[model samples]
Target chain A: MKFIHTGDWHLGKLVHGIYMTEDQRYLLNQFIEVVAEEQPDAVVIAGDLYDRSVPPTDAVELLDEILFKINVELNIPVVAIAGNHDSAERLSFGSSWYRHNHFYLTGKLIYDFRPVQIKGVNFHLVPYAEPGHVRHLLDDSSVHSHQDAMKAVIGKMEQNLNPNEPNILVGHAFVLGGETCESERTLSVGGSGCVSSDLFAPFSYTALGHLHSPDAIRHDKIKYSGSLMKYSFSEAKQRKTISIIEMNENGSFEIRERTLTPRQDMRELEGHLEELLDPKFYEKQKTDDYLKVTLLDDGSLIDPIGKLRKIYPHVLHLERKIESVDQKQLRNFSSIKEEKKSELDLFEQFYREMTTAEFTDEKRELMAGIVNKVLKEEAQK
Target chain B: MKFIHTGDWHLGKLVHGIYMTEDQRYLLNQFIEVVAEEQPDAVVIAGDLYDRSVPPTDAVELLDEILFKINVELNIPVVAIAGNHDSAERLSFGSSWYRHNHFYLTGKLIYDFRPVQIKGVNFHLVPYAEPGHVRHLLDDSSVHSHQDAMKAVIGKMEQNLNPNEPNILVGHAFVLGGETCESERTLSVGGSGCVSSDLFAPFSYTALGHLHSPDAIRHDKIKYSGSLMKYSFSEAKQRKTISIIEMNENGSFEIRERTLTPRQDMRELEGHLEELLDPKFYEKQKTDDYLKVTLLDDGSLIDPIGKLRKIYPHVLHLERKIESVDQKQLRNFSSIKEEKKSELDLFEQFYREMTTAEFTDEKRELMAGIVNKVLKEEAQK
Candidate 1:
């Protein structure tokens, strides 16, 4: 069974006061052409169908047009789930009728892991949920973190799984070793949102979303197709692509990447303002590409952004390299400071603020033991 | 064939800083019961599915649930259209696939009126559009007012009309003699929006919306089902109902009103603050009904709304009777003053205001001729 794995379209994303709807539409039009050529058994959009709960009207229209073209016109089964960015209820509208034409869109998560069976392959879709919600759904006190929630969810799915048959899991989470970048919202306050790749061992392939870079995590069976486009300057170097996975009869899959040409590439440039603005230098670059330019000149430059925009119409952001160098040092110093604090000391402060009770030696020792156990478990994963 | 004609749902309506979603849900629950009992062949919702272009998420959910129940669960066909208050593009989502399930939702108006045929009856749905939009669609320079737009639309429908078939026209417009309430938005600045009832003579029945009162216009063939609820204090006295029509094989129909009781009835109350507050008066009434209290007391009352809300949780508005009486006379005098002006005199003043060019004798004679002709046309209708 062949599956085109893609997600994190973020259809109505806005950065630096500019909407990405047109850019999204341009890529989606190209995506439809890709779907037409590939003719996969089904398309798996892991999650994050929209950038916000209440997307703009044009964004809504664009989604409607694209979904209709793929599911109706192309006659392909769309297996999708709503991510943290979507309002589950809004996305669930007309979903019951949508299934008649093989368009499977799951917004709200359910306790039972009902797999969508298409051509003998069982595809289980798990939409992003808060740890608290998962805890409530499973009625388990042990499900206190994203790892625990995934463990509980996988446990449920495994009960009905046939290991010999092909099984694919589509999910949105911060899996272990997935590199983080700007524009991706932090899943939790503390470091409790990461799940291990070992939990997805039973599945032939696990198509994941949430992280914006395709190189976020690397496992033979688990992979990230990445976001449809670069949403922030931090993601400038990462090339976005959709993974086409062909699962063999023996439950082994071979994956290939199909690069999508964005309407305007998002990248960064660093140089002195005058040197960067020279006609010979500017003419050689893709001036219209969405850019974040960093000026290295020490002296002040008047209206540098305005001057750059005359050439690079889509220049999203401008910054001073000198200021960033200072900020980078500050960030490094802060991280070192954060790491220096012992687990018990951090817990004591957190507990003091969260509760009225005193942090006794007995409580401290118990917490220390638990923290050590968690560290050992994380290392093994 | 039995048809339940209803319109102007105006879901997500906000009045006096209160959301009408819950109340709308309550009424819709009752409406579904009525539908279940009647088992109508098709439920025709003329227009105005939402109060604003972008409704709250809850409103969308409510519409989804109700439509699902009526069209999917109960197996009754639904015919609905978008009104001036709706964002046509938002409503058009999933419309192509919806037809297979007998859910006919028309948002955008096409040049040719395509009738949805069900049970041997042709139902022509005309969604609300501005005169300029209709003008652009028809490419007719003469389409200047709502009347002209409707005339052109009806003319297009007539070209494809088989009058012998039981034809019913569903539209949203301000027909002539429609007694509009405060909640109903003025369709046009002048009297040009009023379409004569005689123009709808071809269709066996013309179901209209936009006017909040069912008695907004009076004709045997043309009727308004009225808005779902009392959306304003001015609509306090009007009774809201849905029309149940039985169209015979001969293209004639008999209509009956099925009154719907709102969760909180909207009504006016005239009394002194003390009397209204007294247990004797309060105990005998439904205090929870949405009230527009007209206090007869001459003196000031501190925190009257807050005080009244103790017993009447939905006291929507409070006003002094004396102040309103004075305002009513002012309104009457203004209308009389407006009526006293001659057409030519008003035109010259209007012409002087609208244009820099002088109003010459030739222009005055031409304006006078047009005004007289319009007056004669209006009189004949």
Candidate 2:
């Protein structure tokens, strides 16, 4: 038995108000090419299939096309789960019909760790879930933490497992041995998300999502295929890959990572404006990559984007830096009398900097009261 | 070629704020049972599979159970389309994958009118579509009205069709020779939502939706099976049915309307509150049916709903009226008002009736201006 493992597509994502739909489409095409070339027996998309609960129309269309190609055209069985970013009900819509075509999609935890048997393999699918969601689903008042809920779920899963056959677990969650990303939803507050990697020792292999690094977790049998693309600046240095796993007759498996080259790579650069503007500066960098340029200018730069984009058409971001001010220089004076200014007057000045609208007399008075209360509390602390 | 034609399910419909989910579930279960009993080559659900685009969780589950039973459990080929009530983009999702299971669902209007070949019959599916959606999909700026857009679409569809085969056109829209309920959406203002029935004459048969009455449209070939259940009071008298269509070797077709009994019946009765509650009422009316009781009381009735439901547990509506309020007396009061009350004062009184909060001075002043403007305009007319 063989299968491809991938997850966290996060289609229709935007970073700092910039739409990444085109870039996402480019990377997803590469994913399709990999699927076509590798031609695995089955595919398992862990979770976080969508970036937001209410995806745009185009995003839905794109996902439809990809799923169609993988499940129908290629005739590969695809099993997917819903993550925190998805509306479980929406994801599970038409899933019953989908099951006939060998596409198993589960969004609810109500099934309580029931394993879906696909071609004699017991696949335990646990979609990304919070402690509260699990507790509500189980209707168990004692389940206060993710670990506790997972334990209960695992217990149920154990009942259905055939110990002789190979058992594979697919989940969309943060394991203990993975680096975190800003886009990945936090499952709990403290130790709730900290699931021990050894919990799945009974399984032949574990496929995971959430962490954006393909190699974030590295147990002999457990692994993370990361995301389909680099979704965050923090993942600029990370390599994106999809895993292809082949199981032998003995229930042992061989796994290999196939690197995906995104249509537009993400790259960050820092230097003076003159050096960056120089044609030689970008000679070493990929011109087609999504660029974030940081300028170490003394003051504000003029038309920085227009100039930089001339050389790099994909320059997505620009940041300017002046000489940093000392932390002590930013502190406020303790006594208003020492500065010969009333607290109300000081509040008026602060209000002007914070808001674009002009403050009225009533608004100024309100601001003064709030500021005084906050300052008094801070002083007491 | 033999197939079942069904439409206007409104799976999660609520009539007059009374939940009919149980009734819908029962009817759909019966529908699947019929499909299994008849064992048609294929099943065509014309449109309006759901009551709303964003259906409740329970509604989704109910729909899933039925679709799964028919398409998956029974191994029947299913083809569905989107209605006016559905979001096309959402419906279109996973359609590509669905094709693998021989379930072809199309939401967008196709310019090329090619029919799907099922058992040597060409199944032409025309989903319910707005003029704007047609225009956008065709990318033809010249397309304006619903009739024009439909004409263009049909013209495109005819090009790919083989008139020799047993061609069946499936559509979900208002057409000539049809009666509609309030539940069916109006296409436009004084617009031709009604297409000429002859447009689909080239096909052996046409299965239509949108109209609620099973006999809303009658033709040798073009027919509307109507909604599965009475979705509105206007459809209370309709005998909900599905068309079982059979195509002979010569490419001609025979159609029959198979009566469908919903899990719960829908009924309306009028009488005094005491009479409705009496054991005599149960002798004639089915207590298991959904009942709309109109209490014919001369004065205000006390707890009319509580009293009526004692016998008719499904009393969905209760209203009291004095038979003495003659239409002649109503006509004497010109403009429906005999009192010399200013429209402003009337509006203020109406506003107070609708809300628990007292109208503030600012709100009262605004309402006064609006009411005065409306009255002055009426006086001018």
Candidate 3:
């Protein structure tokens, strides 16, 4: 049996205040192309199909279109589960009817733990659930964390397991030792979300989501397909990929990675403003890529973001690299109480602090004229 | 071919600040029993399955559970459409896969009008669409109102109609001359939402939703199943029911109404407070019903709502019916302008207006003492 293992599509994700649905649609189109070419027996989406419980309409539509293409248009069985970012009830809608088409989507955890078997391969789908839910579900007080919740759920499946079949476990969890990025939401306040990798010892392959790195964990059977694209600046260095697994008649499987090329890469750049904006510096780079640029120049620059935007249109973050701030702060101290000063005086003080330049007589005169005109308007009101 | 026609469930409806999902669940369970007894060939849900575009999680779960019981468990086909309140794309999700299980849910209006056939009956589903959407979909500039939009959509379907088969039109529309209730949202600012009943001339039966009254329109073949329950006080007198249609081989049908008994009935009670509280008058009434009480006692009352709540726990609204208002008005007039008067003076004037009594010296002394205490506390602050 062969299948494409992927998760954390995070459809309708917002990165730096921009909706990523179009980017997701583009990448998913590519995914469809891959599915069409490979003709995999099944498509296993581990979890986190949406970025949040209530995703925007476009995200929902995009997911619908992609899932239809894979399950209906391409005629492949899809096995999926709801992650923490999803509303289990919302995702579970139409799931029973969908199963007839070989589209199995498990949202809430069930104690029976029936495996969906196809072509002699048993796929155990364990959707993400809170420890409290597991505790109540199993009538066991010992389930107090994500690890314990997963253990209790998976342990129930093991009891009903057929040892001869090539077993595969699909889950959404933060396996201990997996590398994480900023965009991945913390499942628990502390490290209680972490589950041991030893839990998947019985399965030939374990497809996981939650952490954003493709190489999040190192094991022959356990793997993270990673997110579809870089969701945060912290994941700028990560290479996003999908995992393809081919299982033999025995329980052993060979897993390979296929890298996905995002429309524009997420990257970080640090340099002097002038040097960074120069045509020679950015000509070879993907100028439209989402960027976090840090200015190395010590002095204040006028409208630095406005200037850099001409070269990098998608500049998401801009900040100055302040060096030796304590030395300059000590030299520029003044003892004028802000509450005792007029609006013009406060404006002058703010100008001096930002520019480290004197409030000249000409500028002060202009400021005073503006303040008077504003006060005159207020008096009339 | 036989089918149960129902719509305007408004599943997460809020009536008088109370979520009506529990009541809806209670009634829908009865609807399931009706379907089981009838063993209908299909269940046609016209539109407005939810109260809003985005419903609460419990509403979604309830809809899912009911749909599952009908389409999967009972193996009955379901034909549904998106209404004005529903987000089309969201409801349309999983529809493609659902089609295999004989569950057809149409959201947006498509130019291609295909009939979903079951048991020799061809059901033409027309989901609600805006004038702008219909105009764009048909590329017809003449489509400017709800009537015109419905005309254009149904006109397209006419070309593909199989006249030999028994055709049923399921829609969410405000047919012209339909009596609307307060809970039914106005489809348009004026009368543009009204579609002529003549549009359904080609179909054997036209099952509609939107209007809360089951007898909203007077036509032999065209009808509304009404909302699942009375959503507002204006609909308190309206009997909520589902329409069951049994169609014959000769393109004829018999429609019967099945009354749904809600767990709690909404009613209005008008009488003197003392009379209403008397067991002789109240013993025969359903005390648990949601009640709107209009007190006929024109005198000053202390916590009338609090008093009535002891007998009627679900009393949602309360008001006093003032008799001979001119008598009270003549006694309450004073020379002092309301804006210039102190809070205590304003309170005294309000009391006089309500009671038609003079502010006696003893009452005045008591009022002065309370005012002085309040002022002292304010001064300390």
DockQ: which candidate is best?
A: 3
Show model 1 residue runs off by greater than 4 Å.
Answer: A110-112, A135-144, A155-164, A272-279, A298-303, A322-381, B110-112, B138-142, B298-307, B322-381
Best lDDT among the predictions, by candidate number: 3
User: Model 1 over residues B1-381: C-alpha lDDT tens digits?
Assistant: 999999999999999899999999999999999999999999999899999887898999899999999999999999999988988877877887788799999888876587899897899988998899999999999999988999999999998899889999999988887886799877788888788888898899999888988988878898999999999988888879999999998888899999888999989888988899999999999999999988876544688888888988888888765433345544654475557778887777545433435789999999999999999999999
DockQ of each: 0.41, 0.49, 0.69
Ranking by lDDT: 3, 1, 2
lDDT string, candidate 3, A237-324, tens digits:
9889998889987988887778777888899999999999888998978899999998877657999999999999999999776543
Per-candidate count of clashing residue pairs (backbone under 3 Å): 1, 2, 0
Which lDDT tens digits does candidate 2 get at residues B150-239?
676777778887877787788888888887678887767775566777787777888877788878887888888788888766677888
Indicate the residue-level lDDT of A2 in model 1: 90
lDDT by residue for model 1 over A1-381, one digit each (tens)? 898999999988898899999999999999999999999999999889899887887888899899999999999999998888887777877787788888888887777687888988999888888788889998999999899998999889998888878999999888988888889987687779888889998898899988988899978888988999999999999989999989887788888899889989999998988888899899899999999998886545688999988988988888775543345544654475558777777777656433435788999999999999998999999
- Of the true interface contacts, each candidate retains a share of 0.59, 0.59, 0.95
At residue B239, what lDDT does model 2 achieve? 85
For TM-score, candidate 1 versus 3, the one ahead is 3
